[model samples]
Target: MDNNMLILSEGMHTSIQDLGRKGYRAFGVPISGAMDKYSAILANKLLNNDEKLPVMEMTLIGPKILFEDNSLIVLTGADMAPHINGEAIQMNFVYKVTTSDVLSFGNLKTGARTYLGVKGGFLTEEKLNSFSYYEGVTSKEKVQKGDRLKIASIEAGLNPSSSKIKVKSAHFKEKKLEVTKGPEFNRLTKKHRELLFSKEFKIDAHNNRMGYQLKNKFPPIKNGEIITSTTIPGTIQLTPSGKLIIMMRDCPTTGGYPRILQLTDIAINQLAQKKENDSFKFDLESSFDFLGRLVNRFKD
Candidate 1:
């Protein structure tokens, strides 16, 4: 019931993303949502908002905005060098913007995606129990220009906190992502698996809402008759030509051609932040073994 923010100039590809549309993949709807969840969760949690509330998920950079009323918001993930009314804003913290104040985000830094959580959830019409998924949607579209965002809270006289208390931060600290070996991971030649971790792979610029293409030595497989099977986000599928594609939040519900491996939850979040030329190592593990490690990770 709050009119806090309004989309003035929609950026290249900004979407109202939460987690994803669960339980509807069987109907051929891709799991559509934000690519990097770590930042998204962190940004929203700072404001004590629910995980299901839709937020502005941006790739590379964010769009310009003009507030309909005074609001406080927080930003997380890669720094995109934002500015408010020609005054630069800080990263990884919460700040305030007033009505008619213009805000712009520059190019992305180290990572690919960033999350911005306003005082409350971004209020968009819920279509099919979600504002996240945006395929075959007749009611709510992804997001368009001149759209008025319905927020949850209002400010009688609330404005940017003048005290200027800096926001503290948390360490993502995730590196050397673990993976569950694929159905065709063993099918590749012994040298292929060796080369996978042996050399570093660079993320390609051909990335978008769908997936990221990783470039490396390009492995080979002898027998490639794997049936068309179910695929999910974080699935690392390899083409016959040996190119690796890490399915993102908007990834297809299913695929074929045999995936090489599956990135764990922690790893996929970090992978979503990677832009072109970012290099990282991949570690292979058994499904049960990796799951146990993840369970332990959450415990700690």
Candidate 2:
């Protein structure tokens, strides 16, 4: 079927997200979606969907999906042990979801979120011109178990069988995020500036789509400025305890804190998928380099 959709089992942490709805930010709206957009868009494309098709953005655990009708679907981003009717299914590959069949996501295998997208995509209520879900800004809310999804109508109806799946590329090889010092980057001494990237911080459990709080073994802020003003998604805010926070997709539009460094957009998406204490090195790649690398990462 084209868009006839049914949620057989909504995973514990699932949200409807696309590229994101813009123009709501002035009212404190956030552009929320899969942290790993590279993979997110890849899934949509596999379904022959537009780059902005609404996809199921699942966390470390994926939800079970029951199809009301037959459809071609794809899963991308982090590895959430996926299985269909108890049989293991692969990630980053397109598959067919049949009516009366069950699609279940078990646990987080690698990254934090897994994205599920169907051919064309399921149509949900829109807010500010986007089907991407936010804090219930529209009638639709974050995806939950047993939710019924209405397709765009045209995207549904077509029947499909098996999938000609493609391979996925390495994450680290392509993307680079351009980081600029935060608003309060000046607050930290020169030494702090140097150590911001030089120092290694461990991601803590107290992290969410809002931001990632990193454990600082060596806090560099001494005569740090007073904390005030909002922070961006990639902002690395330093707390009084010297902990550093890297904001993410659902991060508040504003915050009053001493943000010393900002992870570039590309890295924000990449690192967002990282598990707790998953160590990675940072290279101060420029915005130009980031885009160039990402484009080259994929084989044409």
Candidate 3:
């Protein structure tokens, strides 16, 4: 039988995602990719596949998939209580399955997103140099029931022992997100700056792939509107109404709001795993200090 996964049920917001489209932001194209890139990369790494290969990004809930051929797969990011043929399985572990095996999920114990990585990756449509499925950029925005995802057929004598890895649970429970000052951060008053770092902000209900809005607000900036400057993922924009919007992977290439702070790459990944109403505080770091830490991290 041909290698394929039949989606019996498309839970919550499952979609195909990769690292995201690069070099097309100049054309007003947003980088629509995996929300928790660190987890997505981990999934691929466990399977010995290309880190940027496409994987199923499951949000809140997970899909019910049926394997049509022998395959190797792994789950990472969220503790979604995954099961294979009614037997519970652990996350961050590699498992080999034969044809007719059914993969399903139970309650999401932690984190907001999960990555399902299959050996050889999924054979999905690629657009603009990426496999990420964006609404307007791709044919379909999210995976739907009845969708059949193509995969590489397992070869003879390719079975390998299952493997598992340990991941720190604190990663999902982290409440401090590191940030660097943005170009307009200096424009804010000292009070606003202090409140931003000291006060806890809750994730607003409007959170999604486009961006995350904070429930708490600060008084309007003296000069709130910007001259349509460039914006990227993790850019924290302060609106005139004092709302804070944290741009995500699918945010527009440019925004008019005043950019006040920028989240570090690690912080962005941490934020992506947060759900609505989740609370967090900003941990400001100077550019020089951040760079020094980055250099030291690479040296280690």
Candidate 4:
């Protein structure tokens, strides 16, 4: 029998994603991929799969899948209570499943998104050289029930190797996000600059893949118009009305808001795991000073 993952039940928002497309954002393409890349890499690492392999990213809830053949699988990121054949499975570990075995998830324990990776990865066609699903780039933007997904062909008799890794608790813990001054950082008044660092911002209900609306009142910036500027994930823009919007993985290539702060890559990963209503402050860091700290943090 051909190896396939049949989607019996689709969750709130489940879609296939990889590292994301690059070199095309200049043409107005958003880089859509796994929101929590660290977790996605962990899932793929457990199965010894390629780092860029496309995996199913589940938001809030997860899906029920039926395996048509034996394969290795791993679940990471949010604890969604994944199970097989009614038996619970632990996260950050590799498991083997056979035909007729069913995978499912229950209530979310923490975090926002979950990633599921198979041994050979999901065999989905790539758009713009990336397996990520963007609305206009891919034929299917999100996975739905009754869809049968192909699994990359693997040789018979190959079994999954047992492997596990423990993730740090701080990755999901709500804490201060580190950010550096942006292009227009100096344009803000001293009082507004102080407020940006001192105030605790809550993620509004309008948060999504595009951007996060931070619900906090800060001193309004004087109206100033500039040429549209290039932006990527982690760019924090402040509007004239004193609203702060943090760009995410699917943010547009260019924006006109005053770019006031830019989150670090680590901060971006931290924000990706956060859901609505979560509050966090900013840890403003200087690029020169943050470099040594970032290097040492990753070195350990």
lDDT (CA) per prediction: 0.73, 0.71, 0.92, 0.88
Single out the weakest 10-residue window by summed lDDT for candidate 2. 167-176
Alpha-carbon RMSD, each predicted model: 3.3, 4.0, 1.6, 2.2
lDDT of 1 at 292: 81
Residue pairs whose backbone atoms clash in candidate 4: none
Residue 65, candidate 3: alpha-carbon lDDT: 95
For residues 136-209, write the lDDT of model 3, one tens digit per residue.
88899999999999987767767655677898876799999999999899999989888888999999999999
Tell me the deviation in Å of residue 80 in model 4: 0.4
- Give the winner by TM-score: 1 or 4: 4
Model 2, 181-252: lDDT tens digits are 567767777676677667655778878777887665546466544635776678877776676778888888
The true-structure Cα RMSD of candidate 4 reads 2.2
| Residue 9 lDDT (model 1) | 79
The candidates, ranked best first by TM-score, are 3, 4, 1, 2
Off by over 4 Å in 4: 293-300
TM-score of predicted model 4? Answer: 0.95
lDDT by residue for model 1 (1-300), tens: 246677877776777788777777888887676677767877777666786667787777678888776677877777788888878787666677666777788876556666778877777767666678475753555456787777666557655443323332322334466688776677777777778777778888788778889767385566554678988888888887777888877778778878888888778888777777877888777667867887898994
Q: Which residue pairs in model 3 clash with each other?
A: none
The TM-score values for the models, in the order shown, are: 0.87, 0.83, 0.96, 0.95
Candidate 1: C-alpha RMSD to true structure equals 3.3
Per-residue CA lDDT of candidate 4, range 81-167, in tens? 999999999999888888889999999998999999999899987889899988898998899999999887667777767657888
Model 2 lDDT, full chain set:
0.71
Task: Flag regions of model 1 displaced more than 4 Å.
Answer: 1-4, 138-142, 155-175, 285-291, 294-300
